[model samples]
Target: MKNSLKLVLAVVLCVFLAGVAGFADEYILGIGFTIFMYIALAQSWVVLSGLTGYISLGHVVFFGSGAYVFILIWGLVPVWLGVFCSGIVVGLVSLIVGYPVLRVRGPYFVILSFGLAELVKNLVLINEARMYVSMRPVFGAPALYQLYTAMLLLAIIATGLTYWIRRSRFGAGLRSIREDEEAAETIGVPVAKLKLLAFAISGVIPAMVGAIFIMRSGIFQSGDAFTPIVSFTMVTMAIIGGSDDAPGPFLGVVFLVLLQELLWVNWPEVYMIILGILLLGFVLFIPNGIYGWLSEKYFGNKKNVT
Candidate 1:
């Protein structure tokens, strides 16, 4: 418990320092917002895929939904209220959608989740979906400042929430489920209930991230929201950084964002191919993720040799 607290504090400190430094610079601040979104995405993915062993590939469903709501409602309502509403809407919808879907296991589950993203994307395009039915872009840079502040606050809160989840009884139950669902169920875990809760929570984070992204980018296309690549990249971030620990998401965001900035524009196709190869390498060589690897090698796996 002490170690976990220390770890959480360290993450907070690092994020705060990073945030402060970003505020100090001009160009870096823009990059800071991007990094913050990735953190939210990677962390949300870890909560569901990492803790529960449910590899959801349609996280964009919640995210895009939120972006649309923010676009449509931001001017009509308080931006914060719009943000919260979007998350709640998507989270509830995820619960409804996940009801039957969560029962499946392994490859089929992954396929279904991945497919939902495409389904949502097509729906948006065909329907002429307005991410912001009435979103008129602000005339200048002042708007960007407000948007950035909102994103920063949301990012910090989301990270803190993950820390709380990691310490809660629900989190412990999730760890058990990840370890062995059958045994966890037999031992009094409300497996379905806990899973639904996690799914709902997981859905909310991305929704908030989406809202911020749309607000800042001023472009909330459904294609942008429902991209399978978004889900894949998020999962890759979590898996490569260390799915077993909270710090893994933070580390994953930093690593992948840097890689994206450095190589994505120059070699878009090659970038994805390299990402795929990196993921394969992590699964095979660093099963525990980079953080997991570091933990075992440095501090040693004191959790017992499972």
Candidate 2:
């Protein structure tokens, strides 16, 4: 019964998103794109950090890397194909590194993730300088509505994957890892394989997101592609929305994106300040997030979906 309602609401949302651009202006489409992109990012984060408690601080690495790949191969392939290639490349790279990366647990894992991201960012910056390329400009971009639709579709796919995984045996194994890794492995949970798979899966969409995202700016700089702010926003949204479940990202993204749209144009730095404050408050107080709070209030228990 609950799942049925969720399906109905999802359908309604898809309909609204699909139809919005027909009448809405560019600003509205931009907002929709931003919200949907964040939804994809946040949900992807949930697939890894939320379930396994790895708490990645460098999620943007995949996003930026994917965009760089896309732009590097730009004009050599169809736009849609480039988007796909971006995701595939990022996923493959994650698989290559996931073994060593996932082995580190707790705060060490957090620091390593952040350190790796910074490392990648600097490498890209230096490479760009060596190539004598300051920024890559995107030419012959798709219409705003088309990119918006693509992001919306990605968001839905990400949410569906998260929802399905959360209810599967795999999700149980993942949660077991979060609860007690050694015990889970002792009980034959296949902890290592599952973590690597989840890490790779979480990486794909964000890369595709970055591929589409660079189109919005019509240019890509190493700095913008690898910006720490993208990583911060993903963690912030997940923390606010409750990374445990599929719906948490939707609630969190909508709330913050709307607030962002209101304050961003007037005082951009102010938005960053507010984001920092909200992060601290949410972490200190409502640690379980909006979804957890609401679930405990109405549905009965604050079930940990992650």
Q: Each candidate's TM vs. the true structure?
A: 0.86, 0.96
- Where in model 2 is the C-alpha error above 4 Å? 265-270
lDDT score, candidate 2, position 149: 95
The lDDT of each candidate is 0.77, 0.92
**Candidate 2 on 1-306: residue-level lDDT in tens?**
487897898799799889997788998899999999999999999999998999999999999999999999999999999999999999999999898999999999999998888899899999999999999999999999999999999999999999889989998899899999999999999999999999999999999999999998899998899898899898999989888888888788998999888778888878888878988998898888988888888888866733
- Per-residue lDDT, model 1, residue 234, is 82
**Residues 180-296, model 1: lDDT tens digits:** 999999999999998888888888989988887776666767777677777877888888888765777878888988888777778987887887788899899887777777778
Best model number under lDDT: 2
Poorest 10 consecutive residues of model 2 by lDDT? 297-306
Tell me the alpha-carbon RMSD of every candidate.
3.4, 1.6
TM-score of 2: 0.96
Largest TM-score belongs to which candidate?
2
TM for candidate 1 is: 0.86
